[model samples]
Target: MSEADVTVIGAGVVGLAVAAALAARGRKVYILEKNEGIGRETSSRNSQVIHAGLYYPPGSLKARTCVEGNRLLYQLCARYGVPHRRLGKLVAATEAGEEPRLEALASNASASGVAGLRFLTSREVAVLEPRVRARLGLLVPDTGIVDVHRLMELYLWLARERGAELVCRTEAVGLEFTGAGYLVWVRDREGTYAFRSRVVVNSAGLRADRVAAMAGLDVDRLGYRLHYCKGHYFSVCPAKSRLVSRLVYPVPHPQGTGLGIHVTLDLGGRMRLGPDTLYVSEPEYGVGEERRHLFWEGARRFLPDLEPEDLSPEMAGIRPKLQGPGQPPRDFVIRHEADRGLPGFVNLIGIESPGLTASPAIARLVAGMLG
Candidate 1:
């Protein structure tokens, strides 16, 4: 059996950040990843946009961490040579009826403490994104794009440098209360084994709820059950990829199902539209070609120049959501479960969108909890 001060399940961005934070504070940390490598799941998928804490309710964990994470992420990018761009984003109301939603979004953002947000009129929107057709728009200057893979690499490097060990192709299959901490049952390519840790962090991304259940939590009773929401992205053909310089989004769904099918630019300046939310029983990453028209119509409301032929199925990702269809939006659930009789067991569930942006801050929060 192996042992450590902390055992982190899942080596996604958040898990890596936690490892870095804990190890930097001199904790003997070991990161156990189910995959052969890291971030092959939700972490590698989805839009890599660094959100400006918009679109979330005020005083929520999503709002607080995103606002703080936006700043810390930028600093981390500069200090660690991570590839990123603060190109900003625009949430536009393409129809007169949608103006109220735009206003609400702006108000929510401001209430959440996001600075540099400017409400843009149609003319201002035209100046920023000439191709987009909108009645009004909210310019969020704090939003940007980041090479998430690079950021994850830096986190791994920092953690390893601080004596955190990353054990890949290892899955934390079970957890047993060991009086003071947990006896984590792990399965690797060779076989299964157990590790003793004073603390266990459940950062299993899509499988976070399952990990919590392993520790005897009634996921359903506590509302920790995760619903998989798959989002598909369609890439713009190179000929029409230059339609937007910055991210362009439609007014988000009122229930927060998604931020609507909009435009997202990668670090390479290529544009992709999509991530229409479709709740699934299990995780899947198939992007159907038939969904191209759905994406085209959604983008066409803002990008008037978009054509159906210009879109092609690109990729897809599954978000571990706490809310189901027609349900109200759910905030991230990050708490030390000591009160639940699982001392030193931290549960990070329903950490989806903005999770990438909020990773570092979430890590610090986790560290503070353990401290």
Candidate 2:
């Protein structure tokens, strides 16, 4: 049996960040990734937007961590030489009657400590985004985008440099308590292997509930219900791309799913719109070409001149949402000794949306729990 101070399941951004943070604290960390590569799942997919803590409810982990992690992530990206840009964002009230709702959003954001939200009038909005027609908009200067793949590589490199081991193509099948520690059963291309760890951190992304089940824990009872929401993205035409300099979003719906099918730019300045929420049964991580028309329709709401030919099917990602549509958003479930009696076992459940933004702070919180 291989022994380690800590074992992190799942090599997604959150798991990698946790491993890096734990390794930085002088813990021998082992990262077991079910896939052949890191972040091939939800991490690599989706809108690579560095959120500005705009829509999460006040005092929720999503709100706090996203607000805190946005600051930390910007600093880390700079310190580690990761490629990122704070291109800013605009939450616009496109409809005439939506201005008050936009104001409420600004107030909520202010309460969450999301700095630099400048309210723009209709003329000002037109000055900023010539193509956008909105009565009011809130410009978030701190909002940005990053090369998520490169950021994951940097985190893996740092963790490995600090003596952390990343075992790819390895899946944790089962786990059992061995009195002294936890014995984890992992299967790779070779076969099954048993490893013992003093601490186990379950950062499994979509399969977090399954991981918890294998560990002999009931996820539902622990306030975890995996409601998968799939989002699809569509590519934007180069000519119409420069229509906006910053991320443009419509005021989020009361459902908590970011509504506006706003435009987002890649690190290379290419633009894409979408990730319209669709509840799926299978929830496999792949884009449905059938959803292209849906994206076109959603895009037309904000970009009136958006044509169907302008949209090309891009990609899709699944969110491991713990709550259902119209339900209150749940805080990230980072249960250590507080909720679970088991020592040195932390289960991260329903870490969606601002999870990327909140990753660093979440890692620190995980480290503190482990200690």
Give TM-scores for every candidate, taking all chains together and pairing residue i with residue i.
Answer: 0.98, 0.96
lDDT of 2 by residue, 1-371 (tens): 37988999999999999999999999999999989989999898878889999787888888988999999999999998889999999887877778888888889989999888899988998888888877887899999998899889988998999999999889999888776778999998889889899889999988898888877787778667688888888888898787778888888766547555778999888889977887777677667667777777766766677888887888888989888776776778888843455678889999988899899889988988877
Measured with C-alpha atoms, the lDDT of residue 34 in candidate 2 is: 88
Q: Choose the strongest candidate by TM-score.
A: 1
lDDT of 1 by residue, 1-371 (tens): 46789999999999999999999999999999989898999999979999999888999999999999999999999998999999999999988778998888889899999999898999988888889888999899999999999999999999999999999989999999989888999998789888799999999999999999999999999999999999999999898888898899999867658889989999988999978999999887888888988898899988888889998888999999999888989999999999999999999999999999999999999999999
Off by over 4 Å in 1: none
lDDT per model vs. reference: 0.93, 0.86
Task: Specify the highest-lDDT model's number.
Answer: 1
